[model samples]
Target: MLTRTEGIVLRTQKYGEADLIVTYLTSDRGIIKAFAKSPRKTKSRFGSSMEPLTHSKISLWGKEQASLPKITQSDIINSFHQVRDDFHDFISVSKLVEMLMALSPENIPNKRLFTFFLNILHTVKASEQGSKDVLHLITQIRLLATIGYAPRLKGCGRCGGKGLNFYPASGTILCSKCAGTPVGEGKSFVRIHDNTVRFYTHSIEWPIHISNRLKPQQVILSELSTLLDKHLTYLLSKKLQSSEFLAGVRG
Candidate 1:
């Protein structure tokens, strides 16, 4: 059977001499892989629509349980050309796609994750200079929330106190009393600043809504990145290469 859906291109790789295997994070199907014939050759129908970060309407045909679907047609909706023109923005967008591909599973339907990715792409392409980092941070927060690993920021996850500090390993906030205890068997506690706590609170509670209005300082971005890195590693059960590169760049 043939089906049409809106999807965001997550990644692509050479499949054969002239074909490409493209992975998409679709609105209806969480993560899907489809084969595009002759995408590498000139005058191919797939064209640039198979590129990472491309948003398009796609037609696919296959059995529901098939690992790879056959792509019948694809129409580009947004290519995010501006991101391609800027090196930093391009890298940022690529990392976002890589993160999605790493975290998402095949055949499951997750509308929130789909919209989260699309919104990040749009924001990265539309923002003026110097907004890439801010946009990236916001997207990471949203992605965490979409994947059900979002941290608690309102009160301590350990003690439920109003005054809170984040423990990345647990993906939750901890109060002063809770902070004194070791979060893990061997790991020591790291003290979090009040401002850092507030920033994370906002990131979790308000997301893009509040993050868009407030510009976080470099220190805050660094701290948040560390926290997110720990959480992602815990959830994925491994470290992300793109995240490692991103951290190096930020450092």
Candidate 2:
């Protein structure tokens, strides 16, 4: 069957000598792995559309029960090349792509998530005066929310109260009164400022467009990042490799 969809290129790998195995987050389809024949040679048709972070309109040949579809055509909708050129931009984009690739399951249609990803690529390119770190954190928090793992920020997870403390290991945001309650495998906790709590609450309530410019202080950003890092690690049962890459890129 011939399938047409527009998707963001999550990553690509060389398949044999001249082809690529491309992973994409599509508008209609959740995730797809397509094989592009001979995209590496001189004057090959795929060009740079297969590069990571490129959003492309793609055509694929789907086979019944196949591991990956064959790519018949690809057109660059927005290469998003600028996002990769700046170190700051690249770090943020890499984190978004890698997290999405890791947690998003295959072939499950999620239009909201797909549109959010596209908007972010555009936002990162258009941003002039903003905290890329804050933007990156917002993106991560939003994805976690969409996937039903968002931290409970408004009230305690164990009890209903407005005063909350962050517990990373059990993935709960507990009220001050309930915060000391022991959780299994008690993991470390990060000190979250009032601003960080507000940031976390706002992210859960607002859309990305509204939350894009919320430049929290560097201290708050660091605290929230540490909190979410622990939360995500606990949920995924592993550290994110893209985070390591992001640290290296930022430094």
Candidate 3:
């Protein structure tokens, strides 16, 4: 069977000396891995279309349930070279991609998630370098919300009580009353400012294209970023590999 779909190269692995295994987020197939024979050679049909972050139109040959399909053709639709070229931008987007792959199930068709990610790539590419820090942060928050992994910071996770502390283990805020409960007791919490909560709420409610309209203070960005990192670490059982690199770069 031959399958045709548009995809963004999430990552690629060397299958042997010459062959490659490419993982992609597809328009119709969510996440899928396809085998590209000898794309590493001096002369190969895939060219640079298999490069990570490249969005391409691809044709795969295999059965519907095949774990790995063979790529027959891949034509570049958008190389997204700019995103991969900038160290800061690439690292920021890479963190999101890591989180996405960790959370999104493979071979599950999610057109909305696919389109949202493509939009993020375009937004990051077009955004000015100076403002990318905030843009990238907002993108992370938005992506989490889009995928239902966003941490709830507005109010208590159990009840609607007001709270300023976020428990990474619970992935939400917990008022003092709620925190006194057995499950919440002894859990560490990050004391957050109301501004961080307001900014987070806005990031989720506002449309992605207009997310730039929001201008948060540096402190708020840092606060929210740290909270998210903790939340993700708890969810994934480890920090995203790119995050430490990003922190070092920013430092």
State which candidate has the highest TM-score: 3
lDDT of candidate 1 over 172-219, digit per residue (tens) = 776667766764432433455677767766766674644667678888
Q: Please provide TM-scores, in order, for all candidate models, with all chains considered together.
A: 0.82, 0.85, 0.92
Give the least accurate 10-residue stretch of model 1, judged by summed lDDT.
Answer: 183-192
Q: Considering TM-score, which of the candidate structures 2 and 3 is the better prediction for this target?
A: 3
lDDT for residue 89 in candidate 1, whole number 0-100: 84
Question: Per-residue alpha-carbon lDDT of model 2 for 180-217, expressed as tens digits?
Answer: 66645474566577788887878767766667657677
- For 113-221, candidate 3 gives per-residue lDDT tens digits of 9999999999999998677888999999988998999999989999889999999978899998888887635488899999999999998888877888889999999
Error of 1 at 211 (Å): 3.7
**Steric clash pairs (candidate 1):** none
If ranked by TM-score, best first, what sequence of candidates would result? 3, 2, 1
After superposing candidate 2, which stretches have Cα over 4 Å from the reference?
43-45, 176-184, 238-251
Q: 188, model 2: CA deviation in Å?
A: 2.4
> How many clashes in each structure?
0, 0, 0
Q: Note the Cα lDDT for every prediction shown.
A: 0.75, 0.78, 0.90
